[model samples]
Target chain A: SQTIHQWPATLVQPVGSPLSLECTVEGTSNPNLYWYRQAAGRGLQLLFYSVGIGQISSEVPQNLSASRPQDRQFILSSKKLLLSDSGFYLCAWNGGTANTEAFFGQGTRLTVV
Target chain B: AQSVSQHNHHVILSEAASLELGCNYSYGGTVNLFWYVQYPGQHLQLLLKYFSGDPLVKGIKGFEAEFIKSKFSFNLRKPSVQWSDTAEYFCAVSSSGNTPLVFGKGTRLSVIA
Candidate 1:
């Protein structure tokens, strides 16, 4: 079975600090990877999605950016964090084909002080 | 922009009671629908999905949902729910196969034993 792993599970960073969150999927190749953010008691908001290595689509413009360095490895990064960046970040993946059900990893709770 | 709307923000029910959560989407093109469940402190899991064919779809854990094209609604239902059913449920829709999913604000269900 395919599974996604994300870390660190929780993070606290001061404003203006660099941020890096990684997500990796095992048992699947060439999967579609996505990054979503959910503010406290809010819905999931799409941030970025990658169809293949070095290909990324940004849904919203903000302080964060996403990159697909490998077929199964996706990373979300920021040169500087903002207080508004505090939220729950979730990593998800699906089969290469479209309309397939997506699988999610344990989300990372990020709090920017 | 296309969006998904979940009517209830929070729902409380006793064990063995019927469950029905409303989900509506605003899009006219070909779309795929899905319902996801997340237990406390766990990752999101796919409860059910609707792509093509049957309008009524059954998912794991005795959960089901029906797609009504005219109403643009996909409502989740369970004949009898248990205390173990306490979780946050999300409804998501993707208009085009290649696009990212648009999620509803989500419904928090608390089933008391």
Candidate 2:
């Protein structure tokens, strides 16, 4: 069975502080990884996605950046967090093949104060 | 590039009521569609998905969605929604094969008892 793990289920950081969120997948190899932000009414926003290690495609222009250093390890980082950056962040992965469903991890709720 | 749109931003319904949430995507070629649900304090879970074959796909929790390629629509339906159905729903789309999934600004379903 495949599973995803995201660290720091909840975070509280001051504005302008550095931020780092980690996500890793188990029981899967070479999966397509993704990062998303979930807000109240704005829905889920795609932040970044990686087809493989060191190959990342950013969906939006923002302060956050994503890196896939390992086949199953993904990291989301920000040099300086802003109040607007506070939200629920999610990590997901798929088989990178046809007719496959993506799996999500327990999201990280970051509150920038 | 692909985009998704969810018609309803927020909906309040009573238990046992019929429910329908509209979803549309911007892409002409082969595409995959998906629906996800997020409980108040839980991760986003896959509700259903459409890749090939039948246009209509049934999901967990007595929910379903229909895909209309001509209309570029994938609308979610529930014959009898329950109070437990009060959660946020998201619609997503992607190109066939290995491609990034794009999501919409989810619909918030609040089913009252």
Candidate 3:
């Protein structure tokens, strides 16, 4: 079975601080990875997705960025966090094909004060 | 660009009540639809999906949805909902093949026992 791991599960950081959230998949290779943010009482917003290593497609323009360093390792980063950047961040993976379902990791709740 | 619309932002129901959540999409081409559920403090999980063939798709925990292409709608249903059915439900759409999904503002279902 494939599993996705994301950390830290919760974080509290001051405004303008650097941020790094990691996600990794095990038992799968060349999977499609995605980053999503869910604001309180709002729908999820796709932040970034990667088809392969070093290939990232951003869905929206925001203060965050994503990277795929390895086949199953994805990272979401920001040079400086904004108050608006605070949300529940989720990492998901899917089979690299059409009509496939996505699997999600336990989301990270980031609070930017 | 693909976009999804979920009609209700929040719903409150009692046990054994029939449930329906409306979802619509705006994309003129081939599309895939999905329903995901998020339990409190847990990761998002796939409830069901529709890609091709049958438009009526059944998901876990007695949930089902129908994809009416003519109306560009995919609405989730349940004949009888339980207290455990209380959760956030999200509707998503992806265009054609190998595309990132677009999500709607989720519907928060609160089923009282």
Model 3, span A7-102: residue lDDT tens: 999999999999999999999999999999998667898999998999999988989999998999999999999999989999999988757888
What RMSD, rounded to one decimal, does every model reach? 1.3, 1.2, 1.1
Better of 1 and 2 by DockQ: 2
Clashing pairs in 1: none
Query: After superposing the true interface residues, what Cα RMSD does each candidate give?
Result: 1.4, 1.3, 1.2
Q: What is the TM-score of each candidate against the true structure?
A: 0.95, 0.96, 0.97
Worst 10 residues of 3 chain A by lDDT: A93-102
lDDT of 3 by residue, B59-92 (tens): 9889999999999999999999999999999999
In candidate 2 the C-alpha lDDT for residue A92 amounts to: 92
- For model 1, how does the per-residue alpha-carbon lDDT over B10-89 read when each residue is reduced to its tens digit? 99999999999999999999899999998988778899999999999999999999999999999999999999999999
Q: What tier of docking accuracy does candidate 2 attain?
A: medium
Ranking by TM-score: 3, 2, 1
Badly placed stretches (over 4 Å) of model 2 are none
When 1 and 2 are scored with TM-score, the better candidate is 2
Per-residue alpha-carbon lDDT of candidate 1 for residues A50-104, written as tens digits (9 for 90 to 100): 8899999998999999999999999999999999999999999988765888889
lDDT by residue (tens digit), candidate 2, A1-113: 99999989999999999999999999989999999998877888889999899999998999999999999999999999999999999999999774677899999999999
lDDT for model 2 comes to 0.92
